[model samples]
Target chain A: MAAGSGRAVVGRQGAPLWLRKLGSMFLNVYAMAGFLYLLLPVFVIVLFSFNEPGITRDGVFRPAVRGVRNYRWGRFSIDAWKDPFKLPDLTNAFQTSLKIAALTTVIAVAIGTLMAIALVKYDFRGKGPISTFLILPLTMPEVVMGLSLLVLFVSWGIPRGFLTILIAHVMFSVSYVATTVKARLRGFEWRLEEAAADLGASPQRTFFKVTLPLITPGIFAAALLTFALSLDDFVITYLNRGPQVTTFPVQIWLTKKSGVPVQINVFATLVLIVSVSIALLGLYVQRRRERPVAD
Target chain B: MSNARSTKRWAPWALLGPGVVWLVVFFAFPLVRLLTTALDDSETTRRLGGGGIKNFTTIPKNYGEVLVRTFTYSLIATLLCIAIGYPMAYFIAMRGGRFKNALLALVVLPFFTTYLIRTIAWRVIVDQEGPLVGFLRWTGMIGDSEGLLGRPISVVFALVYNFLPFMVLPIYVSLEKIDKRLLEAGRDLFASAPRTFRKVTMRLSLPGVFAGSLLTFIPASGDFVNADLLGTDSTLMIGNIIEKNFLKEQFRPGISALSFVLMLLILGGVLLYAKLLGTEDLI
Candidate 1:
């Protein structure tokens, strides 16, 4: 107990720092290793994109040679980069994924923003239940949601194609959009609208000029998130996708049998680049917004 | 005045209408449909009302192994995520003074790539002749007969790898919110560092832990991709079984039954967890 008090005095004076330093150092190493683990697959994907086309042996293009796996960086080749669209249906699938994602984002953001507004700005009957119900889709597994939707479509005699995929995407994406927008709305003050109203702005005019501008960042973030979710969705898309429609993820899944083309890496790399750029841009904007307040 | 008051009362409903209706039709309706279909016997008819309670009862009798494996794998994966994620989250929260946002971004950046592609990259990394395998072989850890692929370890590793960010983010959020002054107070009280961490830090971070574990465990349980890509036939999860029943075997009723069971189990686990953590409002 005496020793402990002595150490506490040293700690209070902020001089007994070795333990804290040692702890932080250890934490830094662990954090670095964790980050490396997260990035290892990404590095492998990008690195192997430059690998030479697998050689065909006995009418089969083997990805790796004997005693060496296909993961190795063999001879560097620019063939994949030169013709990333080598696969026949790759572009079609990419386009389909983009269309679905865009449509889903727009529709989800429209409905979700309104729902978020309602949940935040108004007190109403069934509000608690509605909030809980909205979160249900997020908690449920993708496979269950997909299978159930498939059943619904099949039973309703609705042809399972782009339409069904769109419906399913919107279904899942709304919850996300609403959640994101609601988070943003939580920090918002409704009196801004009231102030605008008192300043002679019409209800619609206040919303468009004042409220919408304030919440635009959240809406934008939500839309981007929804797009990413829709684009990368596999399990649900796989189950709901009709025989005719194939999204990029479904195409990639199918390619597992035929051997994943190097072009898929190229596509994935592009997606990574686009998403990172958007995120960095968002960070920059947020920093800029916070700077004035800090000052 | 009365007319305006009524409009104000209905306004929230009007705002919530489209999104709620869409969810009801696409989300809630499908769940109800799934329950009905699961209870029905598809062998007799494609429509509902033939199987009764047999579908639910047959789950434990028939696919019990798959159900157990799914939870087991998910549980193991969630624990692994916590082990790997907690330290990293702690480091960023406590020590990442100026670069906290940048560090957090680094954690999330890898998720920009498609999840499937990332999992596939694991296949390459753990390939028979891959570097990881080579290293293991060099250390004489794995025999020539023992490979990383087609093993339970690889599947769980893939799951931990993929869903780690989900675990880290929530924990980071909770940990970062913890006031540093509380730690200082504990220190000022002459509490040892480990004791302070346990009593103050860990206790305060329970909500994040609960959220992170749920996020990691739920999806990991439902995921078939890791098991399909990394594991052998022996490691097939309930997800694989459901997928097979739906897509391959074309057994709709059976798939529905399995899916219903899986959903119930997850929902029950989540409710129980939420109750224990007293974090119903956190979600």
Candidate 2:
């Protein structure tokens, strides 16, 4: 309980130095176990993505071993990765997911960034109600959000499909986008814009020159988060995606019902790779930007 | 002056307009519509020919077991997240040194994968013929007939696994923000290290725990995917019921009612929790 970085307690402690170090080691072990538990599934998913599933005569790539699910490790093969989009349904679903996620990111980030800026900078009428209203979606259970939206489309007689999925994705994700951007916007110096304006910059020029660049990091971060959420969204997407529309997650669920496809693992690993790569790239860019300022 | 005043009046709305409109049409109105859907009672009357609020009332009587089970399972998951997440968050915040951001990223990396797939990975881990269960069976720890799949503990564990990052991040943020100088001051004031930690460190991190608990609990309680994919019908949750009801036409009222009950219960619980924790700022 008392362990920390400082040597003050270390020098005064009755316990031996090794024993004190052992206490910290316990925390380290506990943390490693926690991380192991956290990453166990990711490791499984990635490992199984590489597993060569037994192709049955009917063309389904489940485990060849009878009476068991396709999760067991099979002979090592990269067949799934080599032909990642083997299933027509999987390809179609992946395309649809990518499209919705992209569109959702663009729309949510734009709307959320603007809203966040307004809330942070301006004393708008009904700001309280608006803030609470935006926070509502974040608090609402996703199932409720999906069900209600599903019902809304039904009651409104709007066809549930690609557009509905887009709407649903944008709806749930906008708040998250707003919150992320808002957190970033909170500490921003509004005086920068005023200073630009004072230097004879027009409102439009001042915003473009001063404000936009300052908030771009926040906006970028929000967009990345939104893209991930939109891409991986299943429950709401399931509710909104009519029979004709299928996203990656909905396809995975459908596949789960039929059989666990090795290709499913393949595509999922792709998603993990793509997202992690983007995150790393973003981190690298941020680090590079800060280094110059630090120097 | 009038032009400037008008621009000021219209500017914020211009910024807020599209997002607020989208939220109103999609987010806010649907919830209001959900309430009406829950209480509409048209379907209930058509079938049974009598029952006003039975849509809400009958749920407790009919599926009370499922409802209770769902709450308890998620509650246990939330508690587990705190137990597991706190130490992990503490380690990263206090001891991670230069590796904190990387550690946080690792914590969140699992989330980038499809939520369903993550649960499926657990499904693999706990399969009847899978290594873990096979080992357990071999050791006679569990009966040959007994399986890990479809168990309540499995579902709870899935929730914990899925939501652990949420709990950890907030706690990490809070812990990282704590000043080391405070601990030093406690040491100087003749407080023992353990006493300093209890009186200073943990006290400051209460808000994080409060936030993390809500973050873990709300979604876990409402989540159906973990229960659906991991557990059998014997361990169904309210989310499964809501999902089922959403599918069939006759179960419309039940769908909304069950969802409403879930929202209400969660809201009430959060309020009670906030009160107990005395974190008035959150509410």
Candidate 3:
């Protein structure tokens, strides 16, 4: 037993083994706890989606009294899931968010792709300054960005509405898309394009057939990220949106004062599911692509 | 030859045109306008033109407490994030072995959910009768009647929770880059485990530390949602003030002035941090 204990106490590097063992044990516990902290809120949000809207007293949904609270388990019900769109304004806000995200993704991806290509493929005056200037918006606080844009819109006589919100979303998203695409273009081989040109391809054909295909994955990734950013945005959208326009986040902010509806959780769960699916799909595609090269 | 040369010269411009123009018109122009708006007199209602610099004087009287509180809360939150995040990052980078990518993905997965929804969950978790409050009360950390929500501690806790991943990922990136041989070298030289960590590991991870702090600090400082949901009237940050001034109160000039000053302070902090860290590629 003594010999066995000694053998177990020795580490690979022959250092004092108790310290390593203790340190690693502590670290593993800390990491697991941290991950739990990160995931606990998400789990709670999903779990509460199944909760009955509230205790119904004689055909009336009675909310938990303000100061008096209950930690008891809520009865399970699928009513929220069954009628996810029961709240008309919530649905409208969700639709508005989707519209803004889609439009922002399209416009930002187009402009950002061009800018990325310019920065990577060509050298010109103001290239350095322009590259640095693009990062400025990212470093600025979201509140500052939103406030300044509001001031600009008011001064320019542009009515603050869907158009203004769209512009703000695109403005913030373009830098992100550009940065993503530029990082992808870095270390990319120019020889492929050169070879295509040498093989009797026109400039447009070379770009379409060679360069575009090579960068499609990066472009797709950037678009997905930009869409997520736009969808999740609150600060900028809230500040700039007109009374006529309301996105999902703004709706949540407004509704929080008057007891958040259960359908909101249902909507949030759906979004979480969609985003996770996209991420998993991206991972699957990446693995499939990498497998070919590895083999 | 001249035609080819000219085409090459103009190609970059053509490609860069739309995006650069958009940024200039929307981003750059707004910043300039904000400065002018802040400095312009508030009494001149329709003056889209210009006004005197007296509008700047109102900032100290109106927003001094909020400005101070904002930085203090942000600073405390940043410190807490570093404390919690660094250990997790170190563990993953050093001991994750085959599970490294999976662990990193787990860190990022939580953020894909809606930010406000996650914050709202905190409200539920820290409710008056919630398990967390019960645990704290049982542990003698708070009075029996006291709850966790609607307090400064809750606001800061939410901030740390929301931005912890930002701190972790950067630190993990830097920690992962530290060669395994360096740690082995330290051990070979008879340095103890703690010494090895302090000198070799900690020294090298400063860049990540700097990056993580900046990422956490900047966003937390600007955030209003956590404070709004988890805090009471007296616990408002600069973001809450700016939001109130911009939206409800419709104090445009005051909002602009407060925003300009906040941006300048953040800018100064970032520059000073960059200088201290000796890094220029932060963006």
The TM-scores, one per candidate, come to: 0.93, 0.94, 0.92
Report, for every candidate in turn, its global Cα lDDT versus the true structure: 0.87, 0.86, 0.86
User: What is the C-alpha lDDT profile of model 2 across B1-283, one tens digit per residue?
Assistant: 9999999899999999999999999988998888887777575444853245777778878879988998899889999999999999999998888998999999999998989999999999998778899899999999998889989889999999999999999899889889988988887776766788799989889899999999999998889999989889999998888877787756766688789889999999988999998897875
Evaluated on CA atoms against the true complex, candidate 1 attains a DockQ of 0.62
- lDDT digits (tens) for residues B1-283 of candidate 1: 9998999999999999999999999999999999887777556633433266776777787789989989999999999999999998998897788989888988887789998889989998888867899899889999966679999999999999999999999999999899978977888786777888899999899899998998899899899999998898899998898777786434677779889989999989988888887888776
How far out, in Å, is residue B118 in model 1? 0.4
Per-residue C-alpha lDDT of model 3 across residues B1-283, encoded as one tens digit per residue: 9998999999999999999999999999999999887776655522533245545565677678888888989999999999999998998897788888888988887788889989988988998877999999999999999998889889998999999999999899999999978977776676666787899999889889888998899898898999999999888998998877786423677678778889999989888878887775664
Per-residue accuracy of model 2 over A1-295 as CA lDDT, tens digit each: 3444455445663456677578779989999999999999999999998776554456555557542245667557888889877789889999999999999999999998889988998887799988888887877779989998988998899988999999999999889998899999998999988799889999999988888988888888898889989999988998888899999999888878767788888888888998899989999998887886653
- The model with the greatest DockQ is 2
C-alpha positional error of residue B185 in candidate 3 after TM-score superposition, expressed in Å: 2.6
Largest TM-score belongs to which candidate? 2
Clashing pairs in model 3, backbone N/Cα/C closer than 3 A: none
- Which parts of model 3 are misplaced by more than 4 Å? A1-16, A53-73, A293-295, B42-52, B248-250, B280-283
On residues A189-254, what C-alpha lDDT tens digit does candidate 1 reach at each position?
Answer: 899999999999999999999999999989998999999999999999999988899999998888
Predicted complex 2: CAPRI docking category: medium
Residue B214, candidate 2: C-alpha displacement in angstroms? 1.2
Instruction: Give the lowest summed-lDDT range of ten residues in model 1 chain B.
Output: B41-50
| DockQ of each candidate, alpha-carbon based | 0.62, 0.74, 0.58
Give the per-residue lDDT digits (tens) of candidate 3, residues A45-67. Answer: 88878776446667766655552
lDDT of 2 at B267: 91
